[model samples]
Target: MQETLRRMQKKRAAGEGGFTLVELLVVVVIIGVLVAIAVPMYLNYRKGAANKSAESDVRAAVSAVEQFYTENGNKYPDDVVTPGAVGVKVTFKLGAATDGQQVATLSPGNTLVYKQLTTGTYRICGMNEDGKVVYKYESAVGGSVKKTSDANLGDCIGAAAPA
Candidate 1:
């Protein structure tokens, strides 16, 4: 028994007790597979988040425009303006609230446009950081917000124009 224990100790000291190359390779392959699966899911989650943010911005803008119209004798603002407040990077072509027109403040990397389709109808379109999706809020469409994918900035205005 003593001799067997000594032989076993010697084998361990000779670096013969750890994982084999095949075992290590298997672990590495498993990790790679997990990473491959996780990366795309993470990227998809980020894209969905960005799209939701754009939609939120569009909704807020629609609320502000509707408020402005209601408060200012039922007329939509012709232009949007940035308030230049700290931590507010958004700019609007819609005029300032002080000018009897209120505009929504948006997150950074977002672009918003206000279109007065008619005297009583308007559309607010917003795009997020990715710029691949556009969120639109049209007053004439039952005030529902809609999302359009694979869209360009120009499409936000021209493609959705009311005939």
Candidate 2:
């Protein structure tokens, strides 16, 4: 029994008592499976976060426009000025900018497109950094921010909200 114990201790000292190949492979496979499940979930969460950020930007633009309207005789600004004190980057699509227009600052990659639909109505569309998610706020419909189907800003007009 003494000899057997000594032999066992010698084997452990030689690193012969470590995990077998099969045990190590099983652990690696389990880790791979966990990663496979976690990666897609993490990506989806990131996408949702980006969309929410764009929506927040659109809401900020709406607030700035509303403020301008309230302070300036209930008239909306002809075009949003860039690098304003509040909100994200804005691109006016209606026409040339007029003097004394309210400014809306822009972030590096995100963009907000503003258009005066009519004299008393306006629309603002915001795009995420990657330009994949778009959110729009239209005063004519319900003054609620909603996701838009259109991706590009060529027209700067977003589709109507789903019923």
Candidate 3:
């Protein structure tokens, strides 16, 4: 028969035919355990999408500082931001929002920016590093954002004092 079909195609290419180093080390240990459970769940879903894009830029900077404090009556905007003003450069420029040991700030010469132990008055906030769902301006507050070690919330809202 053509030499017994060429010895059955060389005994089906010597029997096993391919993969075997214990099946390529069990597919490289199942792709290294699915990349170690998908890289810390893609780095906590990229830090919860940069903390919901920094709480939607803290409710668009508390509605642009309450519309610049109701069009410049109650004060607040010490000027500086004007450049294109939306979320004011990714949620108030950050470096942990300029710490005095930072958590948020700006004010001096930039006019009114606060955060670190803020007393800018109670208005916008966002909590959820585990203190559990807080938000303020875009609404959803009920108290409980106290996990403070400063993961950069700019101290979270006008903290109930600064008028």
Candidate 4:
């Protein structure tokens, strides 16, 4: 029996060995665990990036609106429509009839039915949502492009000064 065992050991050492099923299973399980952890983390990171992008888009829109306001002597164009070239867009309707809101007419006014484009001109407003100013941006030209502040879109706008 001892001789037989010695011969078996020699065979095993001479490249006659193979991995056991249990060992192979362990390696597979370890890889699966790593994948499970890594996939969700990557997904979460992507979502955060999207939200940041949207916030940025809003800021850019705000700056554009301010620029329009300043340059045209408080005359915000009533319909700053989105150009065809624009991919992403954010549309912002001028605020309601309060808080010094300009009424739209033949000339420039505080209230505008305008659409914000992600590519070209855009607008963002700090809407009075239940006291806190919620930043929302609407794309003037709408299509496959995403402009809303969410996990899907990171910071869409430029690092513009808020209005």
Candidate 5:
């Protein structure tokens, strides 16, 4: 019985050597393929998320600017737009507006910008993840807020927004 048991154990050990190099290499290749596929997907998702975050932030900034206009005698606030008690500051600069021009263009700064086109009309721009200013919000006196552009851009002009 002992001799038979020894023979059985020797047979099992011979048949059950560790995985071959080919099997290990296959496993490594599979892992590499999976990583290659997942990395680009994850990066694209991150970029989309960043764009969405910028959009939401731009909307919030526009709302704050509207409130600022209301609080400050129907004129848009200059230099900065601070929202709520927490005081998130959106910087703004007054763009040059020639006579007979109806659209007031607001160029975005490091933060955001608010441009008063007329007595009540306003335009707001915000910075994208790339640090470029894109037109985000537009409103006329007694009108609703309109989203102007969605592309990340250098200036809010031409294809970016309505002239």
Candidate 6:
């Protein structure tokens, strides 16, 4: 009986059909490495997307200002759009708001600065995740638009006009 039991035990040990602890650990490590690599990539992609979105918003605002200028005798918008100001005519259409609210605010928690240098000379600038002005559109008084930054916007400057 003892000899039979030993033979059965040997058969069971030989037929053990599962992964060893080392093999499982290796697989887990590989998966962990992959996750570590993939997560940052995805996060960067998302950040890039946000930056582009903010840039697009600035583009739209530029277009609106240009259109308004063309329709109103080539004058830049005279609205105070940065919130908490008064006594200015908000005479531009910047994406769902025509009441002096900055178009940059449409980007949802993005830091965008807007300035009207002179009559028909204006700039709309937006910051990236690193708080750098990576996107900017400068509208000169002569109906010309130019891109003035290349910090973090990818492929967004392909259509930039000569400064």
Alpha carbon lDDT of residue 105, candidate 6? 30
lDDT of 5 at 130: 54
Off by over 4 Å in 6: 1-15, 79-105, 128-130, 141-163
Candidates' lDDT values, in order?
A: 0.71, 0.67, 0.43, 0.44, 0.50, 0.54
Candidate 6 residue lDDT tens string, 24-94: 99999999999999999999897777767556656666766666566655555663333212222223234
Q: After superposition, how far is residue 128 of candidate 4 from its true place, in Å?
A: 20
- Looking at model 4, residue 97 earns an lDDT score of 40
Best by lDDT: 1
Query: Which residue segments of model 2 deviate by more than 4 Å?
Result: 1-15, 81-108, 158-163
As for TM-score, the candidate ahead, 1 or 3, is 1
Query: Cα RMSD to native, each candidate?
Result: 4.7, 6.0, 12.9, 13.9, 9.0, 9.2
Cα error, residue 98 of model 5, in Å, equals: 29
lDDT of 4: 0.44
Question: What's each prediction's clash count?
Answer: 8, 3, 6, 22, 0, 0
Model 1 segments more than 4 A misplaced = 1-10, 13-15, 81-88, 91-93, 159-163
1-163: candidate 3 lDDT, tens digit per residue: 9999898799788884676699899999999999999999998896666455445544555555555545545544331221123333323432222321112332111112334222334344544334233344422342432223433234334333222
CA lDDT of 98 in candidate 2?
A: 54
On a 0 to 100 scale, what is the lDDT of residue 12 in model 4?
A: 93
Judged by whole-model lDDT over C-alpha atoms, candidate 6 comes out at: 0.54
How would you encode candidate 4's per-residue C-alpha lDDT over 8-121 as one tens digit per residue? 999999988998899999999999999999999998785555444434434544555555556555655443422111233334434334423432221111111244443454
Decide which is better by TM-score, 2 or 6. Answer: 2
For candidate 5, the 10 contiguous residues with the lowest summed lDDT are 99-108
Q: What is the lDDT of residue 28 in candidate 2?
A: 100
TM-score of each: 0.77, 0.72, 0.37, 0.45, 0.60, 0.59
Writing each residue's lDDT as its tens digit, candidate 2 over 127-151 gives: 7667676677889896579887775
Of the candidates numbered 4 and 6, which has the greater lDDT value? 6
